[model samples]
Target: MITAPLPLDEDLRLRSLKRLEILDSEPEEAFDRIARLAAWAFKVPIVLVSLVDEDRQWFKARHGLATCETPRSVSFCAHAVFSKRMLVVEDALDDERFLDNPLVLGAPHIRFYAGAPLLLADGQVAGTLCLIDTVPRSFDPHDAEVLAGYAQLVERELEVRSQLIRLQTAHERDRRSLAISEARFTTVFKETPVGNALVDLDGRFLDVNQAFCAIVGYSEDTLRTLTFAKVTHPDDLAEDLALVAELLAGKHTAYAMEKRYMRPDGTAIWVSLAVTLVRDAAGVPLHLIAAVQDIDSRKKSEKALRNYHVELEERVRERTAELRRSRDALQTITDNLPALIAVVDRDLRYRFNNEAFRRVFGTPSVALRGASIQDTLSPEVFESLQPLFARALAGERVTCNEVRYRADEERVWCTTYIPAEREGKVTGFYVMSHDVTEQRRTEQRLREKALIDPLTGLANRRALQEELGAILTHVGAVALFFIDLDGFKGINDRFGHDTGDALLREVARRLAATVRAGDMVSRLGGDEFVVVSRGVADAPGAERIAQALCHALARPFVAGGTIVEASASVGVVLRGTGDAARSVRMHDTLALADAAMYEAKRAGRNTWRLARHTAADKVKLNETRYPAEKAKSNAKKHSEF
Candidate 1:
């Protein structure tokens, strides 16, 4: 170990060094061994692995040097990183840098010196490896190079330690984010079909679920004496402690990893843990709630799975020389997996394929191979991947989204394309997808059931969300005309649902004819059907159309020749981003239109209400008060308006 000279101002250097936070740290043996070896090899009395930070220099390891560190102003290593080369003082008395250095002239007298800079990942010269001696001596080059190697070792250790710290921090963040509840605790511990426990901060048992007691072959009373550590196998203690240490340090608040647990009967139970920290309102850590899924079944499953994986891997390795064999193996795996899989070439031609694709697309995997994607799948999906395919062909892997229409029905769902590569260049692509068609169908059916009226097929409240979501994306202006029929509930209660249904159906037919091209008329159920118009030239355009629908409906619908009065409350919400210069958030725009429709009902029944967007207009208005109030008022004035 070499003790380099502290500058003439010793006290000033120590002050600058304290803020680095690396001084007098826990014993990491790698550094301790290097410092010891350096001292003997160089025949010097002092060696230190010193780091330079914002204002201080700290020692991770030191030998022959009594104090932990010094200030940057009086340090040799601070100068070493700036030089961007080794700092070697064959004789401190002769060197100009040393003449003014305090250690050279004072107590820890320094004459010979050598140091190497430890570079951090960010290119900051974080610290240096240094050596020193009291007597003047010229060190050998081999010794200097070996010292440089030791410095590299320190740099590597710094990286490993830093990563560990980061991992601990992430773990702690997860712990802090997730909260605990007795309902969740009981559900997880008692009903989870696995062993579980609640332990205090010190690892003492507080509670164990029935499954845990049964698994350990111990009564609840019998398990109370033991702390968690007492039953943990020796082999599993290190990792268990490592995670716990991170938790204790507040570096991690929760932990989840696989490890075995020792049962009370001295048997080690293989398990997977998902544990979290419980805390009080003031954020003090209280206890740990852990779910121990008895991995014994999963372990048994894994054994079968591992055997299959090994067999699969071996077969693939044997055929690695041929791409076709490899593709075949891939197809085999995909066929058995629960998802649909397909492959496409640079031009979107089908390449290697899988069984799931065959099942869904109605073609054999081999038959589909080499066919164009557009020829096999819908044009919508093929066009969506056009850019992604182009990118993949240009040697880039792409994960792009697409939507495909179901050939069996008029429905669509999402898919993703993952480009495949070879030898540093993308060659083709792999498609792994799930059929979300059912999900979309479910949503549509639910919306229809909730929002659409059975008597009149019209857009319901649930349908409104989807409609607005779609309409807002159109940057072009839109006219939202909310039409509430003048009288319908009275017809239903008096004339029976049969005649009411017919009157509503005729009203729907007349309204549908009055709207222009690209306009939508949906029976919002009962007597309310909203007419949403796109490319509305102006408010007058909406007004003219609203008047036409009102006039068309006024003429007797003649359902059973009962020509009673039927009027409408037309509220037109003129929406879109205001002006060509400003981009209104389309989704928000649709919501505004929805609010304005209810407002039309609010103003009066049978007449229309209109609101146009302007730069001066506030987008966020009181929607809650208007929607419910409008629905109730409209129900009351069913025929009056």
Candidate 2:
């Protein structure tokens, strides 16, 4: 038998093949249809659009073939690439080169082959468009011509695909450059100190900066879901609408005003708004660019000065008409304030201090005029407050609450630091402190009373539901155990209420101790409780937790000298790492777990049962401890349970 010789232009042929860049790509419907058509036209069992690489013949499209490629040395397409025209073997059994070929002798058992070499524009053969038959057949001149026409169509499609790929590569490079430019512009838009918004001509928010979100007390995501008209103050909305109409009508290119924006919590804030119209190249109205400066504090200060002026006018009529004396009277009013107010420079030295501030620090205003906080406060206290000062200096308005011990009494003081800006640069900060010890203590006690269970000291049912709802919002695996104390009512009837309460407390302690630290146990009303655990992997992880909880509760309880004993029936629902796990709701999970608990009780109490809220198996009991003897013995025990 003779082997097929390689073409003299083999290196150039491989270069042309590599230039197509079609290897190892996902199959496209365009190429797949061509292969299917070729197989049907040639009346052959198999047809392949194969490309020969250095070591292998990779199929771009194949019909009726399980493998994607074969060794190049043994490939029928490899032999066909040696000729410019179609190659036909009437009978491979009679052909010297293919008589001992494994493809003709074993699997596929090709006895007839017809292939037209796929020639590129560079006049080099890349591979073939081949047809194969299990039985020997003869191909006439007409068949060869028809096959060659199909091969030309395949080559034309390959060239088009290569051009499309190159164009796509160039387009992707342009897209990436545009994205980088957009990202840099977006960073500046989001982080700028002045509030900025991109709004459509219809007054809908296209994008908003973080400063704008903070000013309106709405998140960036929430603002995008609303129109600017929705957040405008009701009294000011009509005027804002008129201004926008004028802008859209080409009456004004820009406008500025001091307007009010309504916050989410129903509070109004004043802002200095500067709006400019953006237009397309053809002068069509595109969007409105709005820049907002928060001016609430300035507005408040102006109002206060106006009131002081009115009072000064009344004083002039009632007492002296001297201007210098009116100023002295005004200073006296500020000095007598109950709240401690002071202004400190960037160096943390006092620029000005009110009489109230001096009294609180137990220093006279004349001596404390230019003193630093380090002079009055200990090193430890100064260090503790340094970070807050630093944050204020960084242009953040910060509020802090601190406890101060004065002799035998402790007082809580709320201090707010407002950064003072001069010409867009931070110069100093204003400080105000007021006592809020009683109010803070009352709030803390109220919060604890609302969240903690009165009896078990565990979290109540409300907190448990909240925790479960939070987990459902984020995607993760979670397992819930619904535990019901079995035969607790019998103990309450026989041993009395006091003994039952003791057993409940002990059970709560044991349940808390049985789970991981990240897990939460809650008392859901009477004898029912729930445990919500996160980071649990699959059904087996949940089953292990259920088994541990059963063992913890299976221990005996001694209460009120009656030696009360009770066990728990637990049902576990696991949200495994499956496709639909994240979409499951808290209530649905609870209902399924509750149903499984009843199944556990029906399965003769104290043994845990698993249920499918996920893709896992349903109604499965613990595998390690299914007792055939105990099942028969206690089959009728919990029939009423």
Index of the highest-TM-score prediction: 1
lDDT of 1: 0.66
Q: Encode model 2's per-residue lDDT on 550-595: one tens digit a residue.
A: 9889988877666766898998888765557767767677766776
Best model number under lDDT: 2
Least accurate 10 contiguous residues by lDDT in model 2: 315-324
Deviating ranges (above 4 Å) for candidate 1: 1-24, 90-107, 119-126, 135-143, 149-366, 369-384, 389-412, 418-641
Q: What's the distance in Å from true for residue 9, model 1?
A: 28
Candidates' C-alpha lDDT:
0.66, 0.76
The sequence of per-residue lDDT tens digits that candidate 1 reaches over residues 190-215 is 43335667788788888887767866
On the 0 to 100 scale, the lDDT of residue 488 in model 2 is: 80
Candidate 2 whole-model C-alpha lDDT, 0 to 1: 0.76
Q: Residue pairs in steric clash, candidate 2? A: none
